[model samples]
Target: MDRNAKFIAALKRLQGVAPIQVWPATVKSIQGTNCTVDILNTDLIDVDEVNLRADDEATEGVLIVPRVGSLVYVGAVENAVDNLFVCQVSEVDRVEVKIGNSLVTIDKDQVKAVRDKCELTLSDKATLKQDQTTIELSSGKVKINNSATSLKSVLDDLTSLLQNFTVTCAAPGSPSAPFPATITQVTQLSTKINQLLS
Candidate 1:
């Protein structure tokens, strides 16, 4: 063939090769760990039973499951429908990273990290929460808050320690009456403080 004809034939062959399809999709429904989504493009309509991307060797099974209506990425081998797969969950308005049950989300106003039942945040101040307890770190001090019963128990323990405290004079000889009087005053002060705490 002439050079121009050979070049044209090569171009035709290249056009025949199918290209991989990747597009953003909206999650429709979830069944177990699998989900369905509607692709945003006109070529592919909808994909069903798409599994969420998770670690195969994870002992905790699937932890992070995308909610319905969230955006995600879908991929397929050329135009093969059965080979379609959910690549990753896409954060539409924020940047989020998830691994198993751990998640970190970042936005213009705040940053949050969560793992299991614990959540940590960093913004104008830093905060952490585990179950009902919260610890906030800001302005060079750490403030912890817990259940009322827990705080009361701590106070009770302090009261008991103070009530049972004994002061002994370090002198080799018997202390004078003034020393004994000072000890009595300290014990009375401890009792008053404990009563106020209670």
Candidate 2:
């Protein structure tokens, strides 16, 4: 073929393999994993059924659903107008993240988590506050309701006082001391408390 005809043939071959394109858009609606968006700053117009971004293979990673009327960045693969997908969003209505058996969900109202166990480890301290009440954990100590007393310490003091309990006998007919049954019950109570709190 002539040089000019060969050049034209090459251009035709590259026409369908163009670079990806990204456009700013406004979300119009959402259904399942797809949404329609109005492409901004150009005459490109609205695109329908564009895929939303999924963090993982669409089934096991983060999923963010943008609110309607929110701004987003939509990407088109190979510059194809019909192969568009959401790449980034400005505002989200909900977000969900799942990895293995753990899952976390966040929405406008609340955040929820599901897992076998959860643990928070801190270097110095941690506190949970609500209005005037507070629970603080620091230096291997726990303070509840802004008080210095701990449940285990209170139980220990009570057990110690009961174990050493005594009574004054002002009259000869009065009982010499507490009943033997009372002492036995106190010992059993102490044992149970230790088992529960240990």
Candidate 3:
């Protein structure tokens, strides 16, 4: 089987929720007919909760899929476990993809998808780097791991994927806004008292 074909078969064999939500990502390696991608899905919030979790080869694993006419790549990084590339799937085999109306065949040149459920771990700090596979496809958004901030988020990128939100009160002696007591008579009295101290 070809690199694209093997990955496509992997994709087609996939079933259940085990398929990691795959978005296009950097390519890693392509030996023989098997192509690889360094994929990440930002929509997948619980990296720790969801993984292939498959101990046996016969068990189900996550799969990666790209829309038809999409381009994908894998493995070309220097000394890196995975690199990157860009290949447009020229001929799409038929298969049913949950995201779209069409399903791809198990083998074809444009087989821009993979079937693999992965378990990714994190460090003491929030940052994480894990290895996963996918076929070459472009979504105007791509990440090696979607657990953190990427280009897709334009609005300050709010979420655990990139940040952990924290709220703190101002310290004592911190500056305070001057009160315009004229809006209310009670406020005016308080302002007068504060002014006396000034």
lDDT, candidate 2, 102-140, per-residue tens? 777778765666555542323356655433445568888
lDDT of 3 at 179: 35
lDDT of 3 by residue, 1-198 (tens): 899999987876763323333344433333323344444453422112111112213223323333333344322223233222233332333222222322223333333222334222222222222333221223543333232323223233323212533334367777644233322444434444343222
lDDT of each: 0.68, 0.73, 0.33
In candidate 2, which residue pairs clash? Answer: none
The C-alpha stretches of model 2 lying farther than 4 A from their native spots are 1-18, 42-46, 54-57, 117-198
* Candidate ranking (TM-score, best to worst): 2, 1, 3
**Residue 46, candidate 2: alpha-carbon lDDT:** 63
Model 2 scores worst on lDDT over the 10 consecutive residues at 114-123
lDDT of 3 at 150: 30
**C-alpha RMSD (angstroms) for model 1:** 9.9
Q: Worst 10-residue stretch by lDDT in candidate 1?
A: 55-64
The local lDDT score (0 to 100) that residue 151 gets in candidate 3 is: 29
Candidate 1 residue-wise lDDT at 27: 87
